[model samples]
Every structure is written in C-alpha cells, then in structure tokens.
Target chain A: MRIWHGLLIALGLGVAGGLYITAPAPLDAGFASDHTADTEAGALVFAAAGCASCHTAPDGASEGPQVLAGGHAFASDFGTFYAPNISPDPASGIGAWDLPTFARAVTKGVSPDGAHYYPAFPYASYQNMTDADVADLFAYMQTLPASAQPNQPHDVGFPFNIRRGLGLWKVAFMPDGYVTPAPDDPVLARGRYLAEGLAHCAECHTPRNAVGALLTDQWMAGAPNPSGKGRVPNITPAALDWSESDLIEYFTSGFTPDYDSAGGEMVEVIENLSQLPEADRAALAAYVAALPPIPSP
Target chain B: MKRIFGLSLATCALAAAAFAGSHANPALEGAVKARNAQMSVIAYHTGLLGGMAKGDVPYDAATAVAAAENLASAAAMKRAVLWIEGTEQGAVAGSRAKAEIWSDAAGFEEKAVALEAASSAMITAAGTDLDALRAAMADVGGSCGACHKAYRGPKN
Candidate 1:
C-alpha cells in the first residue's frame, strides 16, 4: 500500500508539472516593441476587424458604439461568453495594459495575467494579424471613451472552464500561420488579409469539430451559426454562383443578385463593410470570388 | 403594356379573392402563398433594376424604365389579405414574415408608404442616367430594408 501511494503521488506530480509547463504561452513581450502606433490607420483596421461587433454594450449610454463597454453576449454550445469591457477605463477595461500585453492577448489568446481566453474571442483567426496592425489597433482602442463597466465572467462549465487545459487546446488547434493560401494578385492579397486575419470570416463560414477547433479543410464551406438559430451559407465557388461584380455590389449595397436584402447578424457585418472604402470592398469581393471551390459542409 | 405594375389595393383584393377560392388550408395558407407570390413579383422587378444599377446587366433605357415602373406599381400594392393575423413567422413553416408586422401595423404601413414613394421616384429617373438609377436604387433598397428589419426574420 505504501508503494502504491508513492506511485500515485509521483504520477500526480508529473501531470501537474506538465500543466505548468504548457500554461498559455504568450509571444515574447519584445515582439511589439517596434511598431509605431498610428491612430489614423488604426481606425481603418478597427473598422475592418469589427472590434465593435463583439465588444459593444447591448444598450450602452447615448455616447454610442465608440464607447465599447463590452457586455455583448455570445452564446455557444460550450456556454455563454460575454465580451469583456475593452474601453480605456484604467481598472475596468484594459486601460492600463501595455502594448505588449495587448498584443499577446489579441494575437496569442494569452491574457496579461497568463490565463487563456476562450476561443470565442477568435484568436485562432486573429493570431494571423500582422504586428503593426495589432499595435496600431491597440493605440486606437486607447483613444475610445473609457467606460467603468467591469468585465463579466464567462458561464462556461467545469471541464470547459478550466483555462489551463486551453493551453493544450491551443497547441492542438491555434493556427500558427495564415490558413488562406497566398494569392499572387495584390488586390486579392489585401482581401485575403482582411478576410482571413482581420475579419475572421472563417470563424463562422467554416465548420468546427466537437471541440470547436475549425475544420480548416472545409474553409468557407459554411457552418452552423454559433447561436444555433440558422445555418451560415457556403461562400466557396462551388456554392456561390455570384459573379465577381455581383459580389462587389453585394458587399457595397447588401443587395443580392435577386434583390433580397442582407438580414440577421449579417446586417451588422454589412454596416461595417459599408463604412469601408469601395476599393476595399472590391478587393474583398475579388479574394472571396477567387477562393478555391469547396463543397458545402 | 407597362412592365412596371403597381398592384393597387383593388387588384390585391381581387388576387386575394382568387387565392381564397383555393383550399390548401384556405384563408391562412392561401394568404401566405398570396403574399409570398407578391414578394416574388416585387423581387423580380427589383432584380432587373438592381442588375442595371450594378452594371451586370447592360443598361437599356426602355428596359430600365419598364422595370422601375413595375417596381413602382408593385410597391403601391396594398394586400391586407396577405397579412391577416396568424400568418407570422412561427405560424407557418418557411415563413420569414414576423409578428411585428401585425403588432406594429402602423410602423409597417409607414414603411410601405416609404417604398411607394421611393419606387415612384425611380420610374422616371431610372432611364435618365446610370447615376440616377443608382440613386433611386439606394432609396428603393433603403425602403425595402426598413420593412425587412422589423417584419422579416432570417430565412426559415
């Protein structure tokens, strides 16, 4: 009995040691040391990235969306995850966060205190954001009106709630690189960057496994809406019959070839896209049109 | 014949009576089919004007004018039978129409009025210039969107 107790204790220690070793690893703090924060360019990046879509308060003060107090509720199969206040409030939001800390959180899903953010934050796709874009976004975010709204705790359950285990999940699933193949066309390249890295379009357009890791093999083939109310449509060439021009116009006006208007959550998405330059919309449409055909999932 | 049809109140009532004659769960289901067909007709003309506005379908003055005229007439349609109570989203399978259409009938009528005004403005201007058609398109689209936001749920 003494020998067995010793073995069990030893096994427990090994497991504990492994967990500690694999704790959500952030990129070196020095990675963000060089990019000069440009608030003007950052504003454009913010629009394309759609930070407000996930972070805005449901019924915030009259000051409006610029006050991103971050109480947006996102419901998923795992549980409900509320968007944290990202306003510039010194204590409630990330107001005190250094550029390095902000970069790691946005790009690596590792919080300043080293806890892993649930994948609902979409770091898998965000992990591809260029260093400069992330840095600029951080600077621009700091300019938003500060809100004292404290961050809400996510309602995820036991096994899923264990943040440390997410370190392993990241290792298994976090895309260390861009998933969309690089296109030679410069316009398409810009579109690819916006769609894959900043917009995180695949987060909804691509299906995921039981554990919620994106099924990268079925990129843009459409998936169930995280809210589970309706299915997201397939946009790959195999399913989308829209011509390149049709796509450009759709992005610009939210009008389908058949004249049906965009509905549901996509209305918000179109609002963001509409604020962007027509050239940017054109580029995004071009990239999406050129994507390799994949059958609907 | 004017390709631009504005299904007036009388015409819609007549169409409703015609559909009322059939019985696949009469009244309610017939109302659903009637409204659905009405929407289809509206969408068809919108598409022709939309295609011209987008430059995908080459713009011809006559075709654009006719499409815009059809849109004006369709937008003017007042089919009360199409929205009789109990035809909302949950009441029928594949119905994207929402309860707010009835709950907030005044607001719904305001949107219908907006659509009529927008499409009426388009008929003459659609054949004027590509830019004019585009401007009219924006108005028409806005009117359509305002109603859909309240009355149309996501695709069912």
Candidate 2:
C-alpha cells in the first residue's frame, strides 16, 4: 500500500510538471520595442482590424467613439462570448493596460493574468500582424473615449471553461506567420496583410474542424456563418465571380453585382471597409481576385 | 364577335389586378413569389439610379428622373400585404425575411415609412443636380439598410 501511494504521488508530480512546461507565456520583454506608436497610423489599423464591430455595444445607437462600451455577444458552438469593455476606462476597461500587455492579448491570446483567451477573439489571425501595427493599434485605442461598463463573463460550459486548456489549443494553432506564401507584388502583399492579419477575414470565412481548428487546407472557401445559421460564401477566385471593379464597388456601396446589398454581419464589415481609402479597397479587390480557386467544402 | 373578344380582354385585366391585390395571406408558395416579385421591382429601379449614381452608366438627367419616379412609385405601392405572416424563413424556404417582421409589426411599418420618405426625397432631388442625387442616394441606401439589418437574413 505504501508503494502504491508513492507511485500515485510521482504520477501527480509528473502531470503537474508537464502542465507547467506547456503553459502559455507572455512575450519576452523588449520584443518589438523599436516600433514607436503612432496614433494617426493606429487609427487606420483600428478601423482595418474592425475592433469596434465587436467591442461596440450591440444596438450601437450612439454616434462617434462613444459606442465602444462592449456588450456585443458572439454566440458560437462553444458558447456565447461577451466582448470585454476595451474602452480606456481604468476601472472597468483596458485603460490601465500597457503596450506589452495589449500586444500579448492581441497576438498570443493570453491575458495579462496569464489566462488563455478563447479563439473567439481571433488572435490567431492577429498573431500575424507586425509589431509596429500592434503598437499603433494600442496607441490608437488609448485615444478613444473611456467607458465604465463592467466586463461580462463568458457563458462557456464546464471543462471547456477551463482557460488553461486553451494553452494546448494555442500549441496546436497559434503561430506568427502568413498562412500562405508571401506574394511578390506589393499590392498583393498589402492585400494579404489586410485580409489575413488586421481584418482577420479568415476567422469567419474559413471553415473549422470538429474541434474548432481552422481547416487551412480549404482556406477561404467559406464556411457556415460563425455568428449564426447561414453559410458565408466562398471568396476564392473560382467561386466568387465578381470583377475587380465590382468588388471595389461593393466595398464602397455594399451593393452586390446582383444589386442586392450586403446584409447581416457583412453590413458592419462593409461599413468598416468604406472608411478605408479607395486604394486600399482596390488592393483588397485585386488580391481577392488573384486568390487560387478552391472548391467549396 | 369583336365586342365579345374585347369584353374577355377587359375581364382578364380586372382578374389580374384582383390577383395582385389579393396577395395578402397568400398560400406559402405564392407568398414567396409575390414578395420576390415586389423586391425585384424595387431592385430594378434601384439599379437604374445606382448605375447613374456610381457613374457605371452615364448620368442622363431624363433617365435619373424616370428611375427616381419609378422608385418612389414602387415604395408608395401598398405591397405590405404581400409580407404574409407565415411566409418567413422557417415556414417558407428561399424567403429571407425573418419572423421578426410579423412580431414587430409597428417597427416594420416604421421602416417602410422611412423608405417612402427617402424615396420621396430622391424623387425631389434626382433631376436637380449630381450633388443632390448623391445626397439623396445616401439617404435611400441608409433607409434600405435600416430595414434589412433588422428584418433580413444572411445571404446564402
């Protein structure tokens, strides 16, 4: 009996040791310290990243920057995730968070307290963003009006609610690089950055496996709408039959080639894209038009 | 014999009008067709004006005026009857209207009224100048968007 007790104690220690080694860690200090935060550039990055679409209140009735009170609920198979108040309010928002903490949260999907964030935040795509862009986004977020709304807790079921389990998910999914080979053309490169990095379009456009890992093999062939019931269309060159000009027009006006305007979550996406420069929209159109056509799953 | 033929043609015209007006509480299949036809009319006029607004087609003053008038007429049509109570997503396939339309009848009517107001403004401004047309276009788009976001389903 004593020998068995000793063996169980050894087994417990080994498990604990394995967990400690695999736990998600914050980025090393002094990493990306060279890129200075520019509030002006950050503003554009903030718009491209569509931070306000999720962070803003659901009704979003308020005009200007007052809408970032963050009560939007994203319902998924995992559970409903209430976007946290990202406003600059020191008490209830990220007002007190420093740049490094923000970077870690944005890229590594880890909170300042070392808790793992659910993939619902789309940090997997954001992980591809440049350090400069991340710094700029943090700087721009600081300039927004602070809201005192309290952060809402997620409504995940047990076992899944264990944030530590996400550390293993990060190991399987999280990485800092492009999903596909980098394009040689400058316009394509910019388009790739906007689609894959700041915009995180794949978070919705790409279908996921049973365990919720993205099916990278299919890429942007589209998936069931993450927010609800309908299927998001495949934007690969073969499936999306829009001309480059048609895409730019749709981005600018939200009208499809069929004259039907975009609805649902795409309404917000179009609203954000409309705020970008005409050139940026064109770049996006050009890049999307160039994508290798993948058959829809 | 000619008089009899004329009487039959007149009867057919009256019958068609009655069929169009009686679209309220239509059978499930008929409701989808009626609503889709109504939306198609709206889209047709919207496309004409949209083509001019985006400069995709030449901005002819006469064409702009005609399109704007057609749109206003379409918006003013008493077609709300076509949105039968049971003709939403689950009850009928291929219809993107949500059940919220019936549940929130007052809200839906308010949006319809907003569309009328926007279309009225477009009719007033469409032939005046390019700038006026552009401003009115924004209002029309916004009104359509307001209704769609609340009542329509995601595109398939």
By DockQ, who's the top model here? 1
Q: What TM-score does chain A of model 2 get?
A: 0.93
Q: lDDT (0-100) at residue B150 of candidate 2?
A: 87
Q: For residues A64-176, what per-residue lDDT tens digits would candidate 1 score against the true structure?
A: 54888898899999999999999999899999999888888988888989998898987887888889999889989998999998889999997999898898888888777
Q: List the residue pairs that clash in candidate 2.
A: none
**Each prediction's TM-score versus the true structure:** 0.81, 0.81
What lDDT score is found at residue A286 in candidate 1? 90
Clashing pairs in 1: B4-B69, B4-B70, B5-B70, B5-B73, B6-B73, B6-B74
Model 2 lDDT tens row, B24-129: 4335557688777877887888888777766678777788889888888888777444665556775566788888887897888888898899888888788887
Model 1 spans with C-alpha error above 4 angstroms: A1-13, A27-36, A60-65, B1-34, B59-82, B92-94, B104-150
Error of 1 at A24 (Å): 2.8
Residue-wise lDDT of candidate 1 within B1-156, one digit each (tens)? 222243454355456556756433355676788788777888899889888877878888899899888888877776564676666777655577888887887978988898899989998888798888876776677667757866898775
Residues A160-255, candidate 2, lDDT per residue (tens digit)?
798888888777765456787888999889988898888888888888987688888888999998667779889998699988877876776677
